[model samples]
Target: MSEETFQRYSAYYDLLYRDKDYETEADSVARALRAANPNTHSVLEFGSGTGRHGRLLAEHGFDVFGIERSQTMVTTARSFTDDSAVGRESGIFDCVQGDIQTTTLNRPFHAVLALFHVVSYQTTDADVDRTFANAARHLSADGIFFFDVWHGPAVLHERPAVREKRVEDATTLLTRLAEPRLDVDRHTVTVRYSITAQSKIDNQITEFQEEHCMRYFFPEEITSFARKTGFNVERSEEFLTAQPPSDRTWGVAYLLRKRT
Candidate 1:
């Protein structure tokens, strides 16, 4: 997705995904991180939307730093603080605005994460390779690089389709229509989102459209990319579950370790 798309999408991101179980997902991530590296302490998260996962990971005893491409999202994420009893004045989690493919911190982390199909957003070969390289660059030796992506076999088997969702909060009603156009050769599905939001107080309606091109990946390609980027593919399984990838699984997670 482009920065412009993110700018418009950030406003309603939390509202749109309010029903998503971020806690459970973060728990799954924490479990994976711990199982992969028992001593895992610091994490660098790519595409950390609103710092929800980051905050939960911090609660799991990890110092989390998030890199988000959208400045609006970074600002919104920074607004949230740690109100816990062990409150540190430094805040809960930190987020910076930067692209995953090129951003560099010149620092190493115990774990690197790019959740929520952030890899799939890299629609091109160069983008995907550079993203992998970036992850490897920031990771400590023997550290884990965990990420989820659109499974190519499943994407091809089930195919993309049009879908609509209606969600409302106390003050507003939001309806979103997703229309997908698939390109087999590119292994991409361009989903165009048409959202209509209505304010309950004045009954005012606002509509907007955004396009997101998602790339699906086969395990062989992922392994190849990992090898080229100085990583060994440690595990490949369904996200939040240890099931092997198959035509039935759309979200597949891969755990990779930087070569020592």
Candidate 2:
């Protein structure tokens, strides 16, 4: 993916998902961490866009490290952490720019996370395998892994719909439209975003487009991958809740543990 893919989205990312409850999501993560390992003290997050989750995790007393591929996102995430009191003295959240499939830190983490469809971004077999390998390598023997991805069955059953969203602030008015194209054979969906922004202050308008390719996943496939990578599937369920994954659940979270 081109670095500029998120260049424009990074500017309006906060406004676009202004309603997203990062704190709630972080709470869910914390609960999972506790259930998996009561002594959880460190976390490694991939595709930590905007770093909100990492920031919240840090606030909850976990030392958090994030890896993002987008330079613009890395810059913004760093600014958020660097400007915080925890960042200045506690050294809680530290974000770096790197591809999750290949990037590895010198030390291991107690918990590894790939939230918000970060795993789906791996559009090929090699990409998927390499990502799993990295996850296993970076995790301690007792480490747990958490990831959320689009459910293939649900996506095929419900199908994605066209969406339009408009958000505004004192200085800018923004409109976004999404057009989705599905490749049933490849189990991939390409969502094209058309964004229009008008600055109320200067009356200037800017428009841009971005296309994101997401690969939907199935449970059996995950089980196979986990076994191949020397890990066991501990649990799989709907994200942010205890509901079991079914044909109706579009997003599924999988909890994994290293095999003893």
Write model 1 residue lDDT over 123-230, tens digit each, in one string.
Answer: 998998999999999998899899999999999999988999998999889999999999999999999999999999999999999999899999999999999999
The list of candidate 1 runs beyond 4 A from truth reads: 82-91
The number of clashing residue pairs in each candidate reads: 0, 0
Model 1 lDDT, full chain set: 0.89
Q: lDDT per residue, candidate 2, 42-144, as tens digits?
A: 8899888888888888877788899999888888888887544344434388889999988879998898899889999888878888888888888888688
Q: What TM-score does candidate 1 reach?
A: 0.96
Candidate 2 positional error at 101, Å: 0.7
